[model samples]
Target: MKMNPITLIIVLVFLYPILKGFLFKFSSRDLKCDIDDLSRNISFIIAIISGTYFGKKIFIQHDDGIYRNIYNHIPQQILDYLENNNLIIYAIVIPIIVFIIYRVIKLILDLLNYVTTYPALDSIEKFLSSKGNIFKRTTGMIFQIPKGLCYVLLVAFALNIMSVLNVSSKLNGYLEGSKPYKSICKSIIMPVTNSNIAKKLPNILNNSFRIVIREADSGRQIEPNSDTPATLNQTNGRKTVVYYNGVTLDQGVKSDPQIDKLAVALGSEGTNTTEKAQMLYNWIGTNISYDHDKANKVLNNDFNVRSGAISAFETRKGICFDYSCLYVAMARTNNIKVRLVTGEGFNGISWVSHAWNQVYIPESGKWINVDTTFYKGGNYFDNPRFSIDHKDAQIAGQW
Candidate 1:
């Protein structure tokens, strides 16, 4: 037997989760104590979760490059639509759907096996006085397979139609698919066949996405409503507090040599969001460096402004938390009400953990997020870049 990876994977995949469930059954005995009772159930559940994860990752990754592959492949359109806001599909829905199907299938198989041995497992038996329920359990299987097949066919037919239509413009959205759709599809046709396409997808999507989003958002019209939402709350106040404290002390020493250097470098407050934004921007970028990379330790760190912005008039390397704190302190010093913004940056990469700051301009009365990281080419600013579509960007433990 030639053991191909795909075949080996298929066999192991089915058994692994069932093995884990049995391990659970043996490790902790309860209603799940019956091994025979759960073996088929667990197998069905595993298939469902795998399907759901496959569905959700599709939409989030954006649309595909090929023609036929559009709805069926990784960048599939149908999966995106059904999967959006449907997180439960991954963690529970798929498993439930699979469980129901398998439960029915197993019963039918059991009944069929019984008929082969006894010629008829469907005979009505004595009530509770029966010697064994094994014989009793065999009675219900005959009708389930027909209903299960019908149910399976209906769902499969609907999903197939949805998957096909998703690639069509009639239902789902597409990225400008590329600078020009023809070029991108052509570029991918051969490489995709060779399996080199997945590595290039991020840049390809990035290139084509700006045009796509601009097209998508431009058509959106909204009735103007006057509702002021509160600023994004902070996870810690110490960063905000110490920044203002540094600024408070900086005010007295404004004429001192150290203060004069940064003041000139940052410029006057009335300049511009673009310009005044620079004073804080440059200070953070050039001064703060990632402190062994943990935001939770911000308060306990000893580097302070002395080894940071105060010392380096120009620096561009800091952790997301450090970059955010530097901007907060500098902006507050500029007399602006600065807020620290912290969040997940991309795809739950714990390493993508980040922070930035938002400031309120008295004239506009709106909180504008400022990302020294993005401005310095470090991390992306999710809100400005995608509004909210950037799943990788999360606002975690904001301060």
Candidate 2:
């Protein structure tokens, strides 16, 4: 699905235009442009609008419905298998369609002009056409356009056949109803239970919501506060302990806060998620320190390893892993959908793979990244905009 027609809409809408500027860098030779710019733009516009409105109908909602039905009818292993196949669908469709439509129109327009103009043929014209070796080389690439289309269609046809047969769901009844996994929590600890802290959490989360907003307005490259190393602690065998490093209003070791306390603070059934998140971000940055020594242990050895964000908060110091994991854990305690993201960071000195978090914002119907380690270090990228390295951030059922 990585090369799918519909899935490519995201890339097309966001990044394609920038590539044209780089074309001149490919060669110093002067070349006449053959593209029908108007039709190309029109095709791009149509593709974007159609892909957005129609693509969402399938990718955003219908797929979820299919998954729900499959979960009821299939086994977990089968469901997992189908999910992988389903990804293939998302990665393929829109891109092929967009390319086909755009190219077909461009080809038609270019041919129409050639037919209408019918450049006069004469001895002088022939002499001018005695193409130099350089002109032949340049023209050769353009002649390959039809060949390109055949290859594209071949790929699309083969994928379509593979999809129907391979994207199969089962009816084994091995799975169950889907819960918002990111919001579930397992630990319950009290962080000295400051009435003031309870009161302040909502306000803090609200402020932190601004971090997401800023991220949106700024270019995608300018990320919110992220971390290379964490100042929080590592975890013991417990998973809930790291996520809920602070006080727990509930008896659970997970970071889930007491609904009653939250309700009392907010004066409503829902807590001020934005404010609480902000406060947690602020608290972790100011209260903790990063401990890199614990990170020396490999993650596979301990699924519950607190070396990252989770562990850092527990030990009061960690590398990026601790800060991010703890944020994911604690944020979930407040009923926030925090996803742990594993990737690398660019810090000018060296490149290191790192972990961060993404929280789903219902208001935007999207997941936004939140990096606690950077905030802890005072980078303070407020109201950060969010995008995923990939879709569907996973969770440990325990939030």
Best by TM-score: 1
Task: Show where candidate 1 strays beyond 4 Å.
Answer: 1-260, 286-317, 347-353, 374-383, 386-399
Q: Name the lDDT value of residue 47 in candidate 1.
A: 38
Tens digit of per-residue lDDT, candidate 1, span 145-224 = 33333333233323322322233432212212112222322343223322122232222122110000011223332221
CA lDDT of every candidate? 0.38, 0.38
Total backbone collisions for each predicted model: 17, 81
Q: 1-399 in candidate 2: lDDT tens per residue?
A: 234332243234333333332332212122213223434554554453344334333432333565345346646675455344554433564456456666766677667745652342222235536656455444434433433333333333333333223332221010001111101100100011111212222111110111111122322222223331121222122122222212121222234234224323432333455555566666666666644333333322222333333344446766555566566656665677666555443221112344556667676677555666555322332332112112223332224
